[model samples]
Target chain A: MSSGIRVASLDDIPEGEGIAIDKSVTGTADDIALLRDEDGSVWALDDTCTHEDASLADGWVEGGYVECPLHSSKFCLKSGEVQNLPATKNACPHRVEVRDGEVYLFPNEAP
Target chain B: MSSIIEPATGSGAGPSASGGERPVGAATAAPRGALRRPVEMNRNIDVSGLVDAEGGLLDRSVFTDEQVYRQELRRVFAPSWLFLAHTDQFHKPGDFFTTYMGEDPVIVTMDRNRRIRAYLNSCRHRGARVCRADSGATRNFTCTYHGWSFDLEGKLVSVPNKGGYPESFDTKDWGLVEVPHVESYRGLIFGTWNPEPVALREYLGDMAWYMDAMLDHDDEGTVVVGGVHKWVLEGNWKLAAEQFATDWYHVNMSHTSALTVLAPSGKPKAEIVHRTGRQYTDPNGHGAGFPVHPRNRFDAQTVHKWMDYDALRERLGEARVEGPLTNGHATVFPNFSYLPVNGSIRIWHPKGPDRMEVWAWTIVDASMPPEVREAQRLYNLRTFGPSGIFEQDDGENWSECQAIAHGFITNSVPLNYQMGLGSEREDGRHPGTTSELYSDAAGRGFYRHWRELMNTPAWHEENR
Candidate 1:
């Protein structure tokens, strides 16, 4: 039984950018990063970078990946896989659904 | 002198001289009072018998003893002025670089007042590392563990749950531990943990005259081109330091294959090996060995085009500029060393009695053209970087020496350092004691100073 939380609207995050959802709102272990690709697809992953204590919400989003702002480690938005050095572990990805322009985050559930 | 070099009489079983056994259960003890205090160990090991400076003999146990390595961290490194970083690395307020001083992690920062300072990187609360990045600019270093924030000056500015603490809990008492002394000379920043260290220039002594040829060529000075390169080598840190200080004789033998393969400047091996040079040994433990007339081994034509010979001769006297130009290495006492020809400066960070981590940087004059700087960077990488041709050869010898140094039979044998022992003389040209190129005067001087520091517990007791 999966419960969905209405985090934000589809238009809340701009193209090639990301925003953070606090853990208090999603009830997850870490803050969630809501990223919007250039093609208008939405993805959700843990906000904290695996290599260091830095918010991925402040990172730059492009194509299907987000580059960490602290050490520049990149992570795939769709599956939360690490793409480069300085970071080895994959980030935790969460499920997201868009119903009539409203973004619903299935906290702690894999995509 | 005979007593100092006496053969080890003990069976070479466990820790000798100091009868205390190595603590095995200390790590598992419950953390109660003074959690950050280091484990207590026997510091009185009687190091006077380890080095015979004038007789030119050194005991092998200095390279393998755990007690001696710990004492060195306190007596040798704590009071000495150690190089931290170049001034160019800090251009504005909040610029910072992380480095180590005898395994103690330090954060060198440019405060908001534009003054440079150093602090122990461990947080005041729980001793967690406050800054983790290698180099960056930031206004506040916030601890990720519990949200304790410190300003650029290392003052604890904010803490979570301000109302939870008692009214007597003042934030002023919780700032990061600051290094007591910090100074700079010729753009190189140095710091010391001693509350009252001698002035930087005074401690450097006449070694500054020899360094001016490479550091003070232009009015703008020099800047580090590429960021630092760090790697670990399985050897005693002193092996690398002593080699850079006093052992140019090993180059022709150890690096013969490299010299033959690279043939830098297209010069024949005979021409490069036949050049006569001099070795300088300073009373302050600094040492430099360089040829009287050095040929630019890496592209002489390009170097000639970039350097203004007449201007350099006018600024630094012809005697100082001509000798010690290119193709030489010098060490500033303990761990900091540099090679002029390779455009590399490094610190030999000791990991233990048998291992070290090298942090190196390629430095070039700020006045050089972009192409020249790029050439220097590439040349440095090819010659002295971790996987470079010459470094691999040097690392092999050092690691092998360390492996043999720990053996019970080998540890009883004394290493001879008697090459040119009585040949030191005053040339009136250079400031320090000068000897033949292939001499171990500088190596002897290094051990002499090391013995002095090990025997004397306080800086005030030093005869300097």
Candidate 2:
């Protein structure tokens, strides 16, 4: 079953960008990739990339794709389809919600 | 496939492209470079017999024969794909870096399109290297030997005798001939003497998986940083790559000095390394992986002081840190090694049969803070660059190894690669999906393929 929770509010992420927060869920120290769409909504995903194990939160966000900082491999932020050849697999996107002007991530063990 | 580029897997070629003195292709008459082609022992080679469960025995002739060396230049170095500098090396339009494609000097540049291009360094008219500054921004390359200028695209834009030459000499036909095909598998650039060769990525195969890790998978995205540290060393190209590819066994002895500096406890170096990962051999005979780090000597030196042991723990998390902290080295066949140390990529490229010109670059996340970049570069230079204590010392021995092997006696006697011959474990089991590194896994794998390529005709494939 997929865990659900709130991560951030609309004011947290400005337009045309992304934010990275520590993930303490999964019972292991992990990264939570937090991104806000132009419409000002909260989204979250696993920060560790499956391809090269690099942190996806540190990657560049443009349009709707996140370009991995290492090799320029782009992944669609909305769905995490590996948008390039260098990366063969998709990133794990997490579920999120915005409640009371705060972003709370689901399965919120905060890993 | 008519291109003169050497076959990557299929070692055999027709008589014209044959390995040795057996005349082949446009090279049948005589060689243009310092070396000559081999006669491929021009028979239908049975590669099966050359190597075995142990590995191929590389005749010293393979390393020192002037004729065989020439043959390698043509069949191996000439046609095969050789790496050039990375795209990031040339940051500006006029930026250029000079490297060798065999003995031929080449200048890699960034054109107006920001696309990468390379040209034979020799001038079109008088055959002198058109430009020489090691690396810098130049609007165009003007031949110092005789003032012929060419643009970054290698188009012969200026010639002295514009109107003087008879209608015979055409400027359009004399453009700086590009080095066949130039392509980047990730940010790593490679070129070939032939008109075309396989895509660089396809040539890498499973090797690409690790290359992605070394070049891409990082928080900030790794980059080619500081600058390349170049210095000449005396050693055959294959010898150098072979040393890394399959000769982990040699590290205990060949680099015994490293141990003295590293641990200095009078312990066996190999055991102290804490190496893991399967030492795999690609179908074409390329070798990779020797997961031996954190514990890798250089890392051991820095982990406590420079690198934040805890920050690293937080960043890499627990999985990667404990597992392949020293991920197996990723060898790029022939003569290249992608040394990814937790988070750095060091590249090695050979210039000729002996005497390799090294190019060292650090791979780090693009978003890395400058201090991190500086630390990585310093670590890279300290361990492998010219200033590198290890490299400078290794060069003295490697070059001397070739020079001492100069006589017919040393060249004729076969070198013994028989270490742990019967005990080497097979590919039966492993987590890293690699061959065992307990033995000289890289050495056996490299020599076996060297003989296959050296013996097989350039035009023939085992199946074809």
Candidate 3:
């Protein structure tokens, strides 16, 4: 239940979709992308599609899903579940928390 | 017996060989309908009794014969319940998807009544295909050829000139030849050729039990997340159908290269996974499964401990998925491979004896988180795509096996399946059919059933 290490300050970017690369998953400079939905909330998931290695960060966001550009398959950002076809699996999600004026992601892969 | 069956079967008797004379490579003892005999032997093949306790394996002719391919369209594919797109394809009323039942193009749609319907694509007028796209939603169809139109119910609602036909013309009979039966089990839709094929539920039998592990669990259970990747291949339709249905033996050799790459550069021995699968050939031409298992994985205690049915509160309401995922695959009669991989159902419909189109789709647990879905997709693509290590290797072998038949002598020769020939034992009370997972019984059983389907002139009586 420890708070995530501070990785970025609040004024660095607004809502919608944002990127921060300094987050470390076991010491690797894991580049994570923050997707802000219409509600101004944010969720972080692995930035790549498992099928063809397509970039998931730039994908179209709708109804809490990020769709891969190559095949148009959608994945749930929160749980990393692939909700659509062409893809049969899920993506990876991370822990994100806001403290003071900074946002940090605790990278974990237990799911 | 060996020398008499050879003949020029590559083209299955063209104009020259078609004159009803002895065909090239044809055995002297071969009767008019007999062209399946192999031509040579020695480290290759020995043609003798291609037809066995199960049935007959095709000579090179089955692959190249146009007449044979046409006959199969009716005898094998037509009468069999060909798998079509799942119910997910028809998202709502008026939604539709087209698939081939052998050579016959089919149209499956969700009507206004919310019921699913299927029909031949041919127009009621000149027999031209009525629907042209892969899939769509529409209230009615207007044939571009002669302006013949029909509604979602498949009833001919209009014709450009009503009087174009004679007074005796009956529109009811002309309605798109509605597939007599369309049934969906756990979101998978299938159509049959006979006025009645065995109750699909019954045909499915214990397969449903296995399928439940892959599909039919949880809410929103499975959805068509994307479309199919179709490709043409040169091989008997049965090869593809049988490969998925129950051909686990090929993995040892056909996939040797890919498996080598996936594993730590090795060391001499092949220890990828020790397998034990058996084969069970039914009375009709159906029933094939890997019968292969990565030995000793599904333990009784494990099922009791992990997936306790007391949990069947969700989807099977938690009772299922509690069991370990064992067994490789369970293929239904004619077509449809209910696979254990990526939780997908593959329908390898026959185009001709030697040509086919592959349609694959993924089924995921609806309640699963998106991250899990994404991971599964990645694994599925790496393993099953056209270029996937597994599928790519399979494609090469299936085609090469077909290509080897072109040689006059090689084409007529027979391949040995004599392994475990006399050691096979049949058990009656297993609740399921069983064969040696490590032997050639699967292939032998497959060929046996193929012969029965091909030779049987009558559907109800014992196959000839």
The model with the greatest TM-score is 1
Predicted candidate 2 versus true structure: per-residue lDDT over A7-106, tens digit per residue:
5566867764567766554332567788766656656666776555456665566677777654456877667778885568877676666767787676
Interface RMSD of 1: 6.9
Once fitted onto the true fold, the runs of candidate 2 whose alpha carbons sit more than 4 angstroms away are A1-111, B1-55, B254-257, B264-277, B292-330, B342-354, B418-433, B455-464
- Alpha-carbon deviation at B185 in model 3, angstroms: 2.2
Q: Over the stretch B1-464, how does candidate 2's per-residue lDDT look in tens digits?
A: 11122232233321112242222222223224466435454324333443453643556766665566655555566656677766667676668888777677888887665556677787768788887788887666767664566666666665654677878766555656565456666567777655345666677765554455455444444467766666566786666676656655545555666567755566655545655545666655566656533433225334224544355446554433433335445556676675665343434455545667666666655655677666766766666666665556656767878887778677767676655455444444322235466555556766665656656444322232
lDDT of candidate 1 at residue B158, scale 0 to 100 = 62
**True-vs-predicted CA distance for residue A110, candidate 2, Å:** 74
lDDT of 2 at B99: 77
lDDT score at residue B365, model 2, on the 0-100 scale: 54
Any runs in candidate 1 off by more than 4 Å, and if so which?
A1-111, B1-42, B264-267, B294-301, B459-464
User: What residue runs in model 3 are displaced by over 4 Å at the alpha carbon?
Assistant: A1-111, B1-49, B54-60, B163-166, B217-220, B264-271, B277-281, B288-327, B419-430, B458-464
Model 2, position B147: C-alpha lDDT score: 53
Query: lDDT of all the models against the reference?
Result: 0.79, 0.59, 0.58
